[model samples]
Target: MHKYVKAERERQAQRYRARPHYEQRVNFSVGDYVLRSRVDEKLHANKLRVMWVGPYRVVGSADYYFTVEHLINGRTMDVHPSRLKMYADDSLNVTEELIDHIASQGTLLAVEAIVEYRMNSDMRAYEVKVKWLGLETVEDSWEPLKTMSEDVPQLLLQYATTTSDDVFRRAVTTAIDSKQSQRSTRR
Candidate 1:
């Protein structure tokens, strides 16, 4: 039994040595933009959050990893090649104006859909519950119908039409019509 086990181990070692080894190569060059992988705790406990951020500029390289600098923050870190993916950009240059613009921008939440509507405590206006992109149902927010009408007029119109409430429907229609009129006058 000892002899058989020894022979089997030798055969397994030989088979392992017979297979070819492949090494991961860094495909991106220095000065190229790459996104770094990260976990965010606030956004659905990172379950539905955007795991990769930045268009970090690759500033230096080592034998096994690359150094990256955040364009907006100017912070630097070393990251493995496997932890990064190329960020496609039409222009190769990372201008100071571009970085400043991006840095100056405030956090904007993207709306996935207008899920439901409700009346404000005053009972004079409607508020639509907004489902945000990359967020859970529990995080849906209630926004004023007048505020959302300008941003998502078509969605509000659709939601209002489907509901049986006549007052809410008329209010949505009025809000949308006013927004359209404002745009036309500006044009």
Candidate 2:
């Protein structure tokens, strides 16, 4: 009888422990934006709790902790991964001014092509000429390929298919070769 009681107690404990209690984990990367949860711990706090605060920009990470910058005040803070959610501002419609603001502030630029490339002074990076979406030849600018690729892959794909630009293809080919060689060497 005592053994039966013990077994039943263990089963009950296991059932209780298996009940969901923790929030799901959310992953973040550098340059991603997120809002931090603001849960209150006081009595009946659920009724008064605010969900999130600040659309903070993720700047860096160390293990589970993230360093985020406040988009408005420019303040930097360290926050746990569990307390953060990806930020999406659908509150306003996409306008030209908003696009310009976000483009100027964030690392996102919708453009294509490495029309020309030159080795950086440090010999570690390449500056590639970028042709932005809906822009003319006169406004094209040189940007790092790393940033351009991350921002606009569709544009890159489109630009790479343009058979008319011989110089661009050769530059892109050389860069690809060097990158592949480096990766092989690293292994």
Candidate 3:
């Protein structure tokens, strides 16, 4: 019985060594640059779409996740290893093209401040002129208040109180309150 058990153990060890290693971790060190897989709903529909978005720099790592920061916007995200691929291009043209592609894909830019606000009669929605970080005033554009409430509720609330217009204040307050309630329920 002991000889039979020993043979079975040896066979199991041999099978383990021979089998494919699909569970192997993709090792990434701090300072290594990588690209993250783009997870858009329209990915398969558009054959020409750029799949991977970033050339993010790995800043930190835990057991099964790595913290990567976007090179352009400095946005940090904790991503699984399978979603990341090494970015090794050092050419200036390739980098420029990649940046342009990311911008075209509607990458989230940080909002610096709410410069001004107005009601859009055409859309029947309140719009706020946004000042984006690292961009000039010339690039500022109008964004919907409902969208702003979700993205920057505190900023919208702060701006709402500063305004004397009752209509704008009420609209912004309602949007913020709804957003807060939705968030609380999710928690």
Candidate 4:
């Protein structure tokens, strides 16, 4: 009778596993970047809210659970696999046209401040706040340094010069006119 009971328990467990979506867990690992799904149990109004809110780093993991560290606040959390999704770096897309445009342009953007930079993290980039040649204060934003360095090395070189000496000087009208000539030649 005990043997029969053990066999029956195994059969039940097998049946449970056979069900669709059963025992299926989100696959994630420590050090992976993930966005936590926003789940509000309070009300159904959560549907109108933002779906995901992170590029949080997965710090640790168990069988079907993970620990994530917030990129912004450096907060940590142990979360179920269902709460997380892989963070694809969908931020920057440097087009050939954009690269040519950047390469041709001689306008120099000023680094007003290094507002908040997270050092040598996952992406290996610094988020810098910049004030461009002819932009408003409200237009300043956090941009990845690596993207700038790769796409517009000349701009980086120019920025490097201004940054080291701590002088924010404009490149005068000749540079602007030359840029205009370059733009006109492209057309």
Candidate 5:
């Protein structure tokens, strides 16, 4: 009787463990931005120390592993889905003034520009260029450039001190708007 009871308990435990949790898995694709949780204690010792750090682009992926571009460090890192959060898909729109600010304030230096272009026959191609401090590159294409949020002058300022989200939004809006205007003017 004791052996039979022990076998019954084992069967019940196996059945319970075999049940699926039914949690939906988030899908990430190439070029999609994501935020990765920073596990380093020293960098995130307090609750206020930015819980998430990314806006990292998904560069590659396998069945369960994803390779993301860490813009802050200019490196690609592999991570699991559980460690990543979907970044907000904010439209890239800003004014000319913001572009000027980015250019003059050296914010563009730390970003990589993605250029897209079509030939007279409608054939399209893309190119990537890395921008660094005190350097500039002129690219002719349609692909949009992505700059790290932490590298943005206004965002850096906010991170360094106290500021408002409105300021950050305004700066982003300005920068994106200017780039769009330039593209339109070129065509």
Candidate 6:
């Protein structure tokens, strides 16, 4: 009896051990939205100070890896499948034009626009206005302000506000023109 019990126990253990561990694969595509997990580490004070802070959009993807855009600091990052959860929607399909308009506008336009403009420019100053949905409307009329510089090109002076000389202007203009020419040629 004792021998039979021991053998049964061993058999059970072997069966349990033989079972394969299952891991789910999360596949994300470009433009599909996802969230990024944040890290919190007191031990590494200089490393991370927050935890799980995003419902970011998925910008790119590899086999099992995904790139998510974290909106907290306007950064896009890569994450593994284990760190994501699906976004839930509880509503049925309603084909209202107003609903479509609202959805297209999104909830975080002001924040994203500001971040994008700041990241893309090094010197140009911008004034931004954020209006709440239905509370205010945007007017569509404006002439862009132009700055005058006799010795320097206006575009160069826009970048190097402190410098005012033909040499600086020529160098900056040449660099910009070369870049534009290259881009045109590529197209």
**Which structure among the candidates has the greatest TM-score?**
3
Better of 1 and 2 by TM-score: 1
Over 117-139, each residue of candidate 5 has an lDDT whose tens digit, in order, gives 12233432211223443344542
TM-score of 6: 0.32
TM-score of each: 0.45, 0.36, 0.65, 0.34, 0.36, 0.32
Which residue segments of model 3 deviate by more than 4 Å?
1-21, 25-32, 38-51, 59-65, 89-94, 133-136, 178-187
Model 2 Cα lDDT, one tens digit per residue, 23-106: 455567788877776654643457656456656678899987999876543557899887788875334343567445543543
Can you list the residue pairs that collide in candidate 2?
none
In the range 1-187, model 6's lDDT, one tens digit per residue, is: 9999999999998887777644454655566555445455643575545344445666777876788764333456678877766542223232466344434432332211111011113434321222332332442111111111222234333654444555544545565566567769999
Clashes of 4: 0
Candidate 1 residue 36 Cα shift, in angstroms, is: 12
Top of the candidates by lDDT: 3
lDDT of 4 by residue, 1-187 (tens): 9999999999999999999878665766666777787655543665655356656678888875888875533557788887777874434343567434433333234444433333346765454465543455676766776544444446544555555333221221233345657769999
Error of 6 at 113 (Å): 20
- Of 2 and 6, the candidate ahead on TM-score is 2
Q: List residue ranges in candidate 1 displaced over 4 A.
A: 1-106
* TM-score: model 3 vs. ground truth: 0.65
TM-score quality measure for candidate 5? 0.36
For candidate 3, write residues 1-187 as lDDT tens digits. Answer: 9999999999998889777773565777888878887656644766445468777788899988999987766768999888898876333244677766655665658899998998899999999999998666887999999999999999988988999999999999999999899999999
| Model with the higher TM-score, candidate 1 or 4 | 1
Give candidate 4's error at residue 159 in angstroms.
Answer: 43
Candidate 6 residues lying further than 4 Å off, grouped into runs, are 1-21, 43-50, 72-74, 88-187
